[model samples]
Target: MDAAVLITIVVMTALAFDFTNGFHDTANAMATSIATGALRPRAAVALSAVLNLLGAFLSVEVAKTISGGIVDESQISPAVIFGGLAGAILWNLLTWYVGLPSSSSHALFGGLIGAAWISFGADSVHLTKIVEKILLPALAAPLIAGLVGFIATWITYRITRGVPDRLVTKGFRFGQIASASLVSLAHGTNDAQKTMGVITLTLISAGHLSPGSGPPVWVIVSAGTAIALGTYLGGWRITHTLGKGLTKLEAPQGFAAQTSAATVILTSSHLGFALSTTHVCSGGIIGAGLGGRERDVRWSVARRMAVAWVLTVPAAAVVGAIAGKAASLGTGGVIGVAVVGIAVAVGIYLASRRTPVGPAHVVDELYTPAEPTPARKVA
Candidate 1:
């Protein structure tokens, strides 16, 4: 392929990944609200999509970090970036299918690292930068958010213990509306920038712009729009998992969880840490579940989500490596990889149609926890 054509391909794939990121993480903002009836499923996603677009303009700090900090752009080709994006997109779809709340951020990082490593060797990988920006945040951000959420949940319950149940529920339901919207805005600020950064990096590597350049205005608009559109589509599977699977969410816990997640994500974005909003929000939701004394936290489902989190980076990296190796063969090889990617994506979509999860089913299927095991009969 011509250099221009290749660059265009990579840029479009990056946007596709952004789309996946939006829907995959939509539950981060709207899941609890939807579960608690603070917002209807359609209204929740529509509002989240709008706020996500608005949040994109909040900061360029995370974008700058991604474009310049994580990898040596000069050492790699546009094909490498394309392969990385393919890996991330594939992982996103797979996890979405299984209703696992994995980290799209790590999937992107792993794909980039895997591709760059295969193409240029370990020297192309920025170990120090990865440690500071990606790895550390991956470990710390969630724990911090979890701890904050746990405390907030505990306090909420203790403070409201003797209060009238009706007033408490009504107050928090109203509060959830605000906090969830903020989380959506915070998500856009952090996650949308990942695509912007990738596009900017691709432009730099292609010599379309100098290294360390901010995303072009066109890049910003396109990325924001793509993510917003994806958010509107909604990721119903994961929404069910987070909203109702982990624990039965009520308005107060949902409100606390969103507030805690928003604080962590927005703070990290301002500090230029490309942390996973999915991780932070998931942890917050789990914490919220733990807060409700009568609520049962489903450890099995939580474990499944955790396992997916542990695997996302390596799994995406493996796919990225294979794609990178093929693309390195030639332009034809790049095209071949794209063909396979499209095929796999189509397959997933077709399979999804058999048992589609939509707004109509979001509440009834997800929020209704499994019935408790039958009481043991006398032996």
Candidate 2:
């Protein structure tokens, strides 16, 4: 392939990954609000989509992290990056299919790391930066958000203790709209920038830009548009999982979770930490459930999600390595990888059609009660 054609292909693939990231992480912003009936599912996503676009222009700190920080960009090729994106996109789809709220950010990191390691060597992957910027934040951001959410929930309820239940619920539902919007914006700040970084890195590798150059305006605009469009499509499956599967949420709990998560994500973005908004939001939901003393926190479901989180990086890495290796072969290899990726994507979509989860069904699971287990016989 011509250098320009290859670069164009890689850039398009990056945008596709950005689109997947948008839908995959939509639940991170609007799930709780939707669950609590704070905003209708469609309205919530529309609002999130707009806010995410605005947030993309807010800061380039995280973009810098991706363009220059993670891997030795000098040592990698556009094809390797394309393979990395393929890995992240496939992982995002697989997890979305299973209704697990895994970290799209981690998947991106893992894919890049795997591709770089396979293409060049271990030294090409930045260990310290990964640990400091990616790993540490992944573990801590969620915990911090969870704690804040728990306390915030406790305080919110305590302040409204004497208010009528109806009034309390109404007020908090309104509050959730604002808080959830903030989360959406925060998500844009962090998640959208990852794509910008990747595109900028591609430009640098292709000799269109100098190393350390931030994302150009065109890159930012395209990335933001792709993510916004994806967000509008909605990731109902993951939204359903976070909103209802992790814990049942009331309006106050929803408010707390969104507020806390937004705060954590915005802070991290400002500091250039490529934190997982999904992790922070999940933690917030769990914490909010705990805050409501009467609510049940389903540890079984949570444990399943935790298992997925643990496996996200390594799983994506393995797939990324395979894809990267194949792409490194030549033009025929690139074409082969693209064909396989498209086929896999198409298969997942076709399979999903058999048991569709759309906006109509997004909240149905939340309202439906689980069938009770049969009573035990007397011994």
Candidate 3:
């Protein structure tokens, strides 16, 4: 393939991945608000989409980290990046299908690491930066957000004690709207930048942009638009999982969780840490559950989610490696990877239709018991 054609393919693929990233992590911003009925699902996503576009223009620091920090862009080809994106997109879809709120950020990183490692050897992958920027932040962001969420929830409840329950609920439901909006903004600042970085890296690899250059204006705008559109579409499956599967959230807890998550995500984005918004939000939800005195945090469901989180990176990496190796073979390889990717995507989509989960069904599904008891016959 011509270099220009290859770069075009890679850029398009990056945008596709960005689109997936948006819906996959939509829960990070609006799930709590949705759960608590602070905002209607469609309205919440529309608001999130607008804020996400605005937030993308807020900072390019995380974009710089992805473009230059993760891997040596000079040593890799546009094809390798395409393979990486394919891996990330496939993983995002798979997890979305299962309604597990896995980290789209980690999947992106894992794909790039695997593709780069396979294409250019170990030297191409930056171990130090990965550990410092990606791994450490992954471990700490969630815990910190969870702790803040716990404390905030506790304080919110204590302050509202002796107040009329109806008044308390109404007050916090309003508060949740603002807090959730901030999370959507923070998400744009952080998550949208990942695709910006990927596209910039592609440009650099194709020799269109100089190394060390930040994302160009076009890259920023396209990435922002793609994510915003995806956010609008709303990954109802993951949204359902994060909002209702993790815990039953009252307005106060929802307010606390969104506030804590937005704080952590914005701070991390400013620091150029590619933190997983999913991890941070999930932690916040769990913490809020614990902090609400009457609510029970379902350990069983949490454990299932935890297992998915643990496997996400390595699983995406393995698929990326395979795809990268195949794409390295030349034009035939690229065609083959594209065919397989599309097939897998279609398969997942068709399977999801068997038990469709839409906005109309999300709250009801959450309220339904996972296992219903069989009735005994009366003699």
Q: Cα deviation in Å at residue 276, candidate 1?
A: 1.7
Which whole-number lDDT from 0 to 100 does residue 324 have in model 1? 87
Backbone clash pairs for candidate 3 read none
Candidate 1 per-residue C-alpha lDDT over 1-379 given as tens digits, one digit per residue, 9 for 90 to 100: 5888888888989899999999998998899999988899989999999999988877765455453456676666777788788899999999998888888878887887888888888898888977776667777866888788878988998899899989998999899999899888877877788888888878988899997688888988888898998898889888988898888887889888888898888777677664678888988888778777765688999889878888887788889988988888888988899899999999998776656677755677433323332222100
Worst 10 residues of 2 by lDDT: 370-379
**Please, what are the lDDT tens digits per residue for candidate 2 over residues 1-379?**
6788778888998999999999998999899989999889889899999999998999876445463467787667887888789889999999888778988878887887888888888888888987786678768876888898899999999999899999988999998898888888877877788898888878988899998888888999999999999898898878988888888898999989988887877777677664678888998998898888676788887887888888887777787888888888877777888889999999998776655677755567543323332332110
TM-score of 2: 0.91
Model 3 C-alpha lDDT per residue in residues 274-314, reported as the tens digit of each score: 46788889999998998998767888878878888877777
- Judge candidate 2 at residue 150 and give its lDDT: 90
TM-score for all predictions? 0.91, 0.91, 0.92
Model 2 spans > 4 angstroms off: 59-62, 210-214, 271-274, 365-379
